[model samples]
Target: MVKQPAPDTTRRSEKSRRAIYDAALALVGEVGYPKTTIEGIAARAGVGKQTIYRWWSSKAEVLMEAFLDLGEQSAREAGQESYAFPDTGDLAADLKAVLRATVDELRDPRFEVPSRALAAEGVVNEQLGRELVAKLLEPSLQLYVDRLRTAQDTGEVRQDIDPRIALELFVSPLAQRWLQHTGPIDHTYTDTLVDYALYGLAPR
Candidate 1:
């Protein structure tokens, strides 16, 4: 039989895990992904190097999980269910709400700083970029895909349209704006994107 950890032991582990996540995010933000070492994260987290190794095998793994954890924490702080999109039967409203939340998240220094560092590294490191896309970006994008599929089923979207491609109409614009600093990102901008994407710029 497998032994379960005691309640106090589990609490301590959770605390350590949170600390490690915070330290990993902070270190990556401060020094970029190339310089963020497990030893440095352990030192910042105030845990032994073995502590991190016991939970995560590589710095990439730790940083990935840390970013995911931060997203969940942000969602909770915003009174949202982690990893969920609103489905209030109004697709445009749902998309707008999510995009607004994303804008807020992008504006947050805690999220933006490390995210920019990782993104900069990803621009030059193809393997790491692919891994980050697979591990971090794809899952979030899938939520939009799922939502668009639901819209299609409800006749809110054209039957022949591809949900994945349709999503990019709104999503890609915001992503480009955020990544390139080409324009402002806010509720109005995203709302306009949703309106234009869903209804089209030309009259019906």
Candidate 2:
């Protein structure tokens, strides 16, 4: 068998990978995804295009990984161990806390521009849209799934409720607001979403 790369080589590769991710995010933000090219990413990242191709097959793949890394970084900076919804046993509070953090993230320029470009493209490109939802978005949503499941177990949520669909009640509204410019996104808004989702809209 051929010899594998040394540890130092692997570290260098990781460093290069991060640089490529940063370059891709910046380029997509500045120029939009369709205009972001492998060559441009390579130049901005100071890596060869072959290096990017060695790991990812296309610009879309690169951008997807780039966005994932950005989200993880944001979560870590916010004192979260991972980008998962919290399960503090208080369903409303946990949901509101996470959503408030998300509101801050949505307003972050580094995330907003590139994410907007991808969202715009996804609206018209079904394949890319599904891919983005499946790969970059669904995993995060699953955290809410887990939280909702716990709420169901504790009788906080209705026993017959579908956690997957139920979680979307609060989650999707914020997502739509940010994606489509439908409404404002802030802590108070998200807090109210949590309350409305749990208590219902019919004069509780």
Candidate 3:
């Protein structure tokens, strides 16, 4: 007698969870955070509100998790380790490479649309903003700090410099450009930012 396998409830739950994440990201991107609702996410996801409630407490939690999943998924697709700074012995090359990848991420509609919506909400919702920064933003920044500290140890960077503040020279400018649409962003722009940050404007 041939034996059939039983249904995989774990697989089913994972599918449902992925659908919920997709629905939450799409809804927030399309409608913005202020108008997005748990009910709406459930309807779009083709799942019951109770399904979402079983996993998360509120819309904010679901949306945040969705973004986190999106980042991880993107990282997987790119074959890059999420939140790990690249180390190629040459700090400048490594930073430039990561920044270029960041530019690519920022340019993607799937990321940019929902990201803008979240950024706008985070500006006004203090708790949500803090949580988002703590969960999604700070870890990546910490990677930069760690990398810079390594550079200091190697005599590639000044020991007296604060890695946190020093990172802002390159990171903040690119972020401001992307967030504000103040200028165009591309590989060349990011590469230049890295060079300028490391070498400064003074002629050699």
Which model is ahead, 2 or 3, in terms of lDDT? 3
lDDT of 2 by residue, 1-204 (tens): 112335557778989989999999999888987899999999999998998777788899889988988988987888877766777899999999888888999999999999999999899999999999998888888888888888889989999889889988888999999988999889999999999999999995
Question: How well is each residue in 94-124 modelled by candidate 3, as lDDT tens digits?
Answer: 9999999999999999999999999989989
* TM-score of each candidate structure, all chains considered together: 0.93, 0.92, 0.93
Higher-lDDT candidate among 1 and 2? 1
| After superposition, candidate 2 runs with Cα above 4 Å error | 1-8
Backbone clashes in each candidate structure, one number apiece? 0, 0, 0
Question: What's the CA RMSD for each of the models?
Answer: 3.1, 3.1, 5.8
Which residue pairs come into collision in candidate 2? none
Deviation (Å) of 104 in candidate 2: 0.8
Model 1 superposed RMSD (Cα): 3.1
Task: Tell how far residue 17 is off in model 1, in angstroms.
Answer: 1.0
Scanning candidate 2 in windows of ten residues, the lowest lDDT window is: 1-10
Total backbone clashes of candidate 2, pairs 3 or more residues apart or in separate chains:
0
